[model samples]
Every structure is written in structure tokens, then in C-alpha cells.
Target chain A: DTAVSQTPKYLVTQMGNDKSIKCEQNLGHDTMYWYKQDSKKFLKIMFSYNNKELIINETVPNRFSPKSPDKAHLNLHINSLELGDSAVYFCASSQDRQSEQFFGPGTRLTVL
Target chain B: AQSVAQPEDQVNVAEGNPLTVKCTYSVSGNPYLFWYVQYPNRGLQFLLKYITGDNLVKGSYGFEAEFNKSQTSFHLKKPSALVSDSALYFCAVRARYNDYKLSFGAGTTVTVRA
Candidate 1:
């Protein structure tokens, strides 16, 4: 079974489209995070939520929003997708802030 | 600002040879360091971490790291290398307190040849 899982592993859409990536963790973690990995393989943190509360918001665009229905689930929704948004997005979780992070298989989004 | 530096973009080694991937960090307070490995087309897997109490920390897949406070380094080391050990390795650092967000390096790619 997948410890940390994300849906729609491969997403292809047109510009100006809206899409959402859903993530869930079965490891009983209280902290969750979103990271974006570009084609260059540069991974950067986007946002973080602890127990469904937003704790960290990096220099991400406003078009991107993170919602945590509960601790196990943290979903990312992007509005007005652009070609620049084409990249693999990863979902990760940890038991605490400084603990080791468990990452899910990334969702590769392609905007045409 | 917290930052991690993996100075080498890529490291090459032969099978059965010793390998080392260097990492250094900077933070306001004492740092918590970690290393993760990513194979092709897969998400990163946690390799090891150094929170406290140990200068040399060991983790999965026969990998270990030495935390050097004086040098601000946490270098990943393996006694003998295998072809499968070749992967993209990331070094991350964060504050010691809770709710700490990690700052990761650019990553070092290891290539093992026969």
C-alpha cells in the first residue's frame, strides 16, 4: 500500500484550465507540505499545513491554493494554469515539523 | 535564511569503490540535517537524518552521514558502491524547533560505473 499517495499522476490540459491534485497520507502524520519540481529537477516548497491549518506559505503564486480537509489530506488547486505551471508537483508529510518527510509519487502536469 | 549546499552537481565512482556526497548547511540556530535519494521517475525516499546525539547517522540502503558542526557539513558516505546506488541525492536543513520547514540543496547525482 502507498504510504503517501497522490491522484492523477499524469495531467495534461490546456492553458487557462483549472486542475486539482489530491494527496492523502496513511502514516498518521500531522504535518503536510507541497513541493514543485521543475524540469531542471529543482524542488522547492510551496506551502505547508499542520493539522489542517496553514503554517508555511512560500513565495508561491496566488493562483495556487492548498486546502486540508483533515490531517491526512492536503489538496492543491491551481486556477488559470499557464505553460509555466507545467511541472511535477509532489506531496509530502511528516509526523512533526523537523521530522523526516514522506513523499508521494509526483503528479506531472503538462499545460498545452 | 536556512540553506543547504550540495556543491557537486554530479559524482562518479566505480562499483565496489567508496563514495561520498558532500553537503553543507547554514541556519540561525542548531540545524537538523537530512538526506534523501530519488531514483529515476520516482519520488524522493528518505535516507537518513541527524537530529541530535550522534555525529554519524546511518539509514536505509546502507547509507550514512557524518554531521560536522565545525564545518557545517553532513556528508553522505558509503563504504562500497553499487550500480543501483546511483541516484539523485538531496541534502536538506532546517531549524531545531518544531514546525521547521526544510531548505534543500540543488541535489547531487551519483553515477556508478562497472
Candidate 2:
């Protein structure tokens, strides 16, 4: 069974299109995170939510917003996507702040 | 600011030989160090972590990491390298007293030759 899963594994859209990527974890974790891996393979934290509460918000652009409906799901919505938004988005979850994080199969976003 | 650095961009080793991937970090308080591996077209997978206690922590697939506090390094090592073990490895860190976000290194690609 997949401990973490992201929907729309592959998303391809034109510039200025709005898109959303969904993430869910089944490991009963309280903290979830969103990460972006650029073309150079540098993984950076975009946002983190603990018990549906915003905990960490990096200097990501306001065009990107994260929403956590519950402790099990954290979804990312992109507004007016641009070519620079093309990269792989990863979803992760952990029991607490100091626990090892479990990552889901990333969603490859391609803004053409 | 908390950050992790992987000095080497790539490491090549022959099968059956020992291998090491270097990682260093800078944090204000006690650091939570972790190692993760990623294959092509896949997300990162947790390998091991050093929270406290022993300096050497063993992890999956016969992987182990040595935590050197003075040196501020947590290097991943394997006694014998396998071809299938080759992949992109990342070292991550998060201050124990800080937020839940983990800062990752630039990643090192390990290529084990048959």
C-alpha cells in the first residue's frame, strides 16, 4: 500500500492556466509538507502544515497557495502558472517535527 | 539559517568497493540529520537519520551514516557498493527546536559500475 500518494501524477498545461495538485497520506501523520524540485534537482521546501495548521511557509510566490482540508490531505493550487513553474512537486508527511518524513510519488508539472 | 551542503556532485565506485557520500550542515540548535535516496523519475526515499545517541546509525539496504558533531557532518557510507545501489542521494537537516520543514542538500549522484 502507498503510504503517501499524489493525484495527477503528470500534469501538462499551457502558461497562465490554473492547476491544482492533490496529496494524501495514510500513515496517520500529523504534519505534511510540499516540496519543489527544480530542474537542477535542488529540493526546496515550499510549505508545511501540522494538524491542518500552517507551520512553515517559505519565500514562495503568492501565486502558489497550499490548503489542508484535514491532517490526511494537503493540496497545492497554482494561479496563473508560468513556464518557471515547471518542475516536480513532492508531498511528504511525518509524525512530528523531528520524525523521519515519508514522501509520495511526485507529480511532474510541465507548464508549456 | 539552516542549510545542508553536499560537496561532491557525483561519485563513481566499482561494485564490491566501499563508497561514501559526504554531507555537511549548519544549524543553530541541535540538528536532526537525515539521508534520503532518489531514483530516476521517483520521489525521495528516507534512508536513515541521526537524532541523538550513538554516533553511527544504521539504515535500510545495509546503509549507515556517521554523525560527527564537531565536524558538523553526517556522511552516508556502505561497505560494499552494488550497481543497483546507484542513485541520487540527498542529505537533509532540521533544527530539533525549529519548525517541521527540512532543508535538503544539492544532492549527490552515485554511480556504481559493474
Candidate 3:
């Protein structure tokens, strides 16, 4: 069974277009996070939610918004996407504030 | 700020031989360290972690890591390397009392030759 899964494994879009990526976790974790992996393979945390509440917003662009309707789901919505946004986005979840995180398969977003 | 460093860009080892991927960390207070592996076009898989326990912590796929407080390092090691074990390894660290976010290293590519 997949512990954490992401929908639309591959996303290709044009500049100025809005897009969204969905992530779900079956691990029953309370904390979920969104990370972006650049072409250089550097992973950076963008947002984190605990119990459906925003906890950490790592200075991401205002155009990037993360919504957690429930603890098991965290969706990322990007408004007016830019070419620089082309990268693999990963979703992760942990049991609590301090624990190992399980990651999703990742969504490859391509902004043409 | 907390950070992790993976000195080697890549580590190559022959099958049936022991392998090691070096990882060092920097943090203020107590730290929570972790090791994760990633295959091509996949997500990171949890390997092991060091919260506060024996120096040697073991995890899935016969993987183990040694936590050396004096060195501020948690290196991943395996007794016998397999070709299938080759992947990208990442080291992450987070302050024990800080937020839930983890700071990851640059990642080291492991290639096991058969």
C-alpha cells in the first residue's frame, strides 16, 4: 500500500496559467509539508501544516498557496505560474512535530 | 540555522563490499537526524533516524547509521552493497525543540557496481 501519494504525476502548463497539485497521506499523520526540488536536486521546504493549520511558510511567493482542508490532505495551488517554477514538488507527512517523514512520489511541474 | 552537509557528490562501491556515505550536520540545541534514499524519478524513502539512543541505529533494507555526537555526524553504512541499493542519499537535520521542518543536505549519489 502506498503510504503517501500524489495525483497527476506529471504536469505541463504554460506561463501565467494557474495549476494545482493534490497530495494525500494514509499514514494518519498530523503534519504535512510541501517541498520543491530544483533542477540541481536541492530540496527546499515551501510550506508545512499541522492538524490542518498552517505552521510554517518558508517565504514562498505569495502566488503559491497551500490549503489543508483536512489533516490527510494538503493541496498546493500556484497562481500565474512562471517558467522558473518548473521542478519536482514533493509532499511529506509526519506523525507529529518531531518524527520521521514519509514522502510522496512527487509531481513534476513543467511551465512552458 | 540548521544545515546538513554531504561532503561527497558520489560514492561508488563494488557489490559484496561494504559502503559508507558521509553526512555531517550543524544545529543549535539537540538535533534530530535522519537518512533517506531516493530512486530515479521517485520520492525519498525513510532510512533511519537518530533522536536519542544507542549510537548505532538500524533501519529497513539492512541499512544502519552511526550517530557520533562528538563529530556531529550520522553516516549511513551497509555490510554488503548490492547493485539495487544504488540511489541518491540525503541527510537531514532538525532542532529537537524547533519547528517540524527538516533541513536536507545536497544529497550524495551512490553507485554500486556488480
Recovered share of real interface contacts in candidate 3: 0.80
lDDT of candidate 1 over B3-86, digit per residue (tens): 989999999999999999999999887889999999998999999999899799999989999999999999999999999999
Fraction of real interface contacts that model 2 preserves: 0.88
Report the Cα lDDT for residue A45, model 1.
Answer: 94
lDDT of 1 at A67: 96
> Number of the top candidate by lDDT?
2
After superposition, which runs of candidate 3 have C-alpha atoms over 4 Å from their true positions?
none
Q: Which candidate ranks first by TM-score, i.e. highest?
A: 2
Model 3 CA lDDT for position B4: 98
DockQ of 3: 0.86
Q: What is the DockQ of each candidate?
A: 0.77, 0.88, 0.86
Clashing pairs in 1: none
Q: How many clashing residue pairs are found in candidate 2?
A: 0
Worst 10 residues of 3 chain A by lDDT: A94-103
* lDDT by residue for model 2 (A13-63), tens: 999999999999999999999999999999999999999999899999999
Q: 2 or 3: which has the higher DockQ?
A: 2
Candidates ranked by lDDT: 2, 3, 1
| Top candidate, metric DockQ | 2
> How many pairs collide in each candidate, listed in order?
0, 0, 0
The worst-scoring run of ten residues by lDDT in candidate 3 chain B lies at: B94-103
